[model samples]
Every structure is written in structure tokens, then in C-alpha cells.
Target: MAIAARALGPSPYGPPEGGLRNAADLIVRDAVAYAGRCDPRVSVSGEVVTGGISAVLIGESRRAFAVVLGDRGLGGFTGLLVGSVAVQVTAHARCPVLIARGTARENGPVVVGVDGSPHSDRAVAFAAEEAVLRKTDLRAVHAWTGPASTRAGDMLPLVYDPELVGEDESRLLSEATAGLTERHPDLLVAHRVVRGRAARTLIGQSHGAQLVVVGARGRGGFTGLLLGSVSQALLHHAECPVAVVRAAEV
Candidate 1:
């Protein structure tokens, strides 16, 4: 389905009239035409609504399997990597939100961030399905940081073994992806546990990835926050398409 939203203005006399409606019609028409060319077997539909674009899209997202938007929209500054609409929709959408960005590499694997959160578990499942559909491997990555005291200059150095920390992180990754191979018998899955920040690690992995999948909110996210920092970072900096999956309600 192709949907377009137009911002309408108040008029004392009557409904405001101009080329905005025409522009919306043309956008929907072109989109429908393109979808038809891409796949004639699938039924295609279009709708043109009048409201804030982000709000309209978020309302429509309830029934959508995934809301796909471009990295940058028409209204944002040319230099902005991600537009305001994309960010807003991704944060509040009911389902997965995919931000279409750089060219997707045909042979790249599906990369997912695994942080042992319920949200991350959902992301892992989503990535596993995507990898199977794409006939590609799934790479689950878990990024961790050392103890906070180690980073503080004024604090006494804590005696903690780096090797033990690495092992624990690896175990976390294994647990997060425990049943993936069993669920997808034919899928190839790889695991990586890196000692770094989650956002930076995932962004680096995105360089040659077809898609990077992450939970909308991770372990560190507060209950009131819809989007987490890691997801936001990837939305702005990932080199490939990024899929932010919102965990289902308990």
C-alpha cells in the first residue's frame, strides 16, 4: 500500500484549495504505478490523508507489518542523515520500523544486536526470520563494557579479569541465541561478543550488512522511553537499512 500525508491549513471561508492535494495525488499515483511494476501479483492500494505526516503514519502503523521510511525526508536539511519524521515514527510505531538507507549488499548477512533484554530477544527472532527469507546468515552480536570504576580516573583500580568478562559476555550471547538454530534448521547463525559500546559495535557491523536489526528499547531504556540510545544511533549512522523491532506486550 502507498500512503501520502498532506498538511492542511485552516481557512475562514472554506477548505483551503491549492496544488497540495494535486501533489499528493501524483505521489500516490506514482507509488502505485511503481509497486505494480515491481510485483503485479500483489494487490496495491494508495491513500492520501490530510494531517501531520508523522502522526498519520503512526496511526496507520497499527495494522502494518512494518513501516518503511527513507533515511531523510523532503522537509529536513540536506545535510541531515535522518529526518525528524523517520525518527518519530520509528520510536512510536506499533510494529517494526525499517529505515531505508545505503544500498543493500546482495550477499551481506543479517546482523542483530543481542543484549539479553526481552526486546533484544524479539529482535533476534525477527532477524532470524529475515535471514531465512533472504537466504543469508544471521550474525548475533553482543557488546559489553568493563566495570564503571575502571573508567574513572579518580577511582581505585578494581582487580577484575578481562578474560572472565569476555567469557561472560560470550555466554550471554549464546543464551540469547539459544534456540535459533533449532528453530531454523537450514539457517546459518554466527555469534560475536565484542568489548565495546553497543551502538558503535552495531554501526561497524552495519558496514557490510544487508540489514541491522535491534530492539526499539534495550536493557538500559527507561519504561517511559519508547526509543533507546543504541537504536537511535543506528538510525542516524548505520550504512545499511536498519530495522527497529518493538517487543510485543506481555
Candidate 2:
């Protein structure tokens, strides 16, 4: 395990000089000691840097299993939970980024967002592994918006049918989660097809979840884009820790 902290500025309002460094060292020692109490094989290290928090986190993510951030922090920045810094790091982190929400619980399902893209598929796999690790259930959620599109007055003449679209969305959700039960026979899985905006649906699910998993980029996003709107929204608004899984390269 690696514990890192960034010293942003020199002012008292900012981190005191060497404060982050000392915090980093303490975190490393405490983490190692805690892990040792749990199991003697765990080793940990410390890394403290003087730079922008988002930049340091992004850099650390290249080699870390996951980069975890608090839902809110003491930076005096207004956007704490769903803020710009969280958005930036979650969008661009190379590895999976986990935004810690509530207390890390030992129970409750691992919730994942699915959109029939390869990106979401990766999220499913990650969520599966997480479910196995947590010894919990996995809940796959998919959201569609026939009603919202109609409200937006963007409905096409023959192509826009609410019932058919909803069915298709359900089918896509099933297809995306297919074979997971067979692969992980011990893992229990459930799925829901919701009618609303994707972000709102996922955020609602987060209330009952221990962790919410999503793809860094989803089907609705451009290929070159670093993060989808839904992922960005979850990073800020989720009531539970949100995992943004990067898509595998072709």
C-alpha cells in the first residue's frame, strides 16, 4: 500500500509546511500497522509531494490499484464532493478511481452502471471482483430516457417508441451481464432497468449500495473524451464510494 499527500500552498489556510508530508508518513505507518494487525504480509510506503492535489493524484494513479479520495475535504473549495478537482482526477486517472462516500461498510451490494459498452463491461468485471472480495451481491443498473426525450421535444416520428426503447434497454442490460453468474458461481447478481436520467438513477441506487462502479467513459461519450457525464455526476453526487473503471484498450 502507498500513502501520498500533496502540499498545495504555503499559507496557514493551505497545508502548513511539511504538514502533508508528516500526514503522509503517519498514514503509511498507520496503514501498515493496521494491515499487519489484520495480516502480517502487508507492506506499505509513503510518498509526499508539494504540488496540485489533482495532478499528484493523477500521477500516482498510473501505478496504483486505485486512487481513493474523500467525498469532501478541507481545501475550502466550494465544490468538495462533486467539485472540479474530484471531477478532473476521476476523469483522467489511469487506474480505477474510487471516491469515498460514506463509511466503508462490510455489507450491502456493489452497485454498477451498465450501458452496453465495452467500458461498462469492464466496470461489470471490476464490480464482480469487488463483490467477490466483499462477499456481497452485485447490482447492475441501467437507465433509459424515452420520457425525457419526449419532454425535450426531440422525439422522432416512427423511431421513438417508449415501450420498445425500454425493452431494448432491459435487453442490453441483460446482455451486458450475461455469463457473470456462470463465471463466478458463488456470486449473487441482480439487475434493474430504470426510467430516468442515468446519473440520477445511479445516484439513487448509491443510497443503498456499499460501492457504486461506473466506466470512466460510457457509450454516450466521445471516444477521445476522458470521462462521461454520468461518471462525472456520480463522482460528485454518489452517496457511496464511486469506482470509475477505465476501459480496456482494443
Candidate 3:
């Protein structure tokens, strides 16, 4: 089933009640028509909810498997308004949140973030399933820094070698995706280890991707922080759709 919703709020200027209703009706009509024609077997519903957009959408997402949102702005500034809503929902919703960027390529690979965290494990599992559903290749990316850089900026940068760090990161990435490809025998998987800021690297890699999947919280994310910086960055800047996957319910 597909649900198309418009969260309404009081507007001081512009349309009156009747005009607003007409506009809402037109929006829903177009949405339903497009949705219906997309897949005949899929059932679609249109709704207009009165409240803050974020809260209304988050509430509706509780019973949904995933909440899909569109990137509001154009190419360079994609998700200007939608980023806030996407982050809010992804941080608090009980289910996964999918932020679809306007610049996404429908036929590209699915990129997934990996850092060996439990949250990332869930992300990988979800990405694997998504790759199967989309019938695309899955690219697992792990970003890591050298020990010297890993330390706070206050500390002097040590001239350390990345040989050891790279080896360990490779091992961790392999361990994280060990059984995933086996589980989905027909799925093709690729792994990469990059050294840099996690968010920037992921955003750059997302340029040609159809979708980017990341954990709601990662290794560096504190428990109190609602969402990790990497995931938050992807919501705002990824070229393709981004999926924020939370840890599985116990």
C-alpha cells in the first residue's frame, strides 16, 4: 500500500479555506493518479493531516515499514526544507526513513555505510534486502582515520603509517559483510575502505548511486545524540536517496 500525505498548517497569507481544500484535493489527485499508474497491484491512499509536518509524518511512520520523503530543492541545494523533516523522522521514528533526492539515478548501485557498529550491522542487513529488491549491486564503504588523526585535534598529528590501520579496517569491513552475500546468493557485493571524514566520503561516493544506506547512529555517535553526523549529512547532501536504518527491535 502507498500513502501520500500533505501536512497542513495555518497560513496567514494566500488561500482561504475553500481554496486551500481545492489545492489539497488537486495535490492528492495528482499523487494518487501517478501512484496508481506506477503499479496496478499497489493500493494507494491520500491524506491531509493538520499539524506540524514533521510531527504528523513521524506519527504516521510508526505503522509504516519505511517513510519515503522527497528532496525539496534543486540539484546543488537538494533537501533544503526536506532535510529537516527527514532528520527528525529518521531520528525518532520506529521504522526506517528513506530520503529520496531529486538528483538520484534510478539505475545506479546501492551504497551502504559500514563501521562495524551494531547500528551499521542493521544498516547493512537492510541495504542487502534493498539491493535484492532493486536488483542492483551493493557497495559497502568503510571510512577510517589513522591513529594520530583519530586523536583529538589538540594533540599533535603524528606521522603514522596507514598500513596497519588499513589492514584492520579491511578486516572489520569484511567481518561486517561476511555472511550478507552468502545469504543473498544472487546479489553482487563490493567493499571499499576510504580514509577521510565519514560524511564527506559517503556524500562524494553517493554521486552516482541510486541509494545510500547508513545507520541512524554509528560508532562515533553518542547515545544521547538522536542521529549520527554521517547519516545527518547524507540526508542533506547525498545525490541519491538515503535510507537511515535503526537497530532491529529486540
lDDT of 2: 0.81
Candidate 3 residue pairs that clash: none
Where model 3 places Cα greater than 4 Å from the true spot, the runs are 1-19, 73-83, 148-160
TM-score of each: 0.87, 0.79, 0.82
Q: Rank the candidates by lDDT, best first.
A: 1, 3, 2
Which candidate number maximizes TM-score?
1
Residue-wise C-alpha lDDT for candidate 2, range 1-250, written one tens digit per residue: 9967544345566555545456666776786677578777666555556677899999999998998776666564774556566778887888898887764456989999998778899999999999998999999999987632312246546557789788888888899999998989999989899998899999899986889999987766456788889998887778888899998582
What are the per-residue Cα lDDT tens digits for candidate 1 across 1-250? Answer: 9977544443446554535666688799999999899889989999999787999999989999999999987788988779999999998999899999976788999999998888999999999999999999999999888733312244634677889878878888899999888999999999998889999999999989999999998877457888999999999999999999998882
lDDT for model 1, please.
0.88
What's the alpha carbon RMSD for model 2? Answer: 6.3
Between the candidate structures 1 and 2, which one is better when assessed by lDDT? 1
The Cα local distance difference test for each model comes to: 0.88, 0.81, 0.82
TM-score of 2: 0.79
For model 2 the local lDDT of residue 112 reads 95
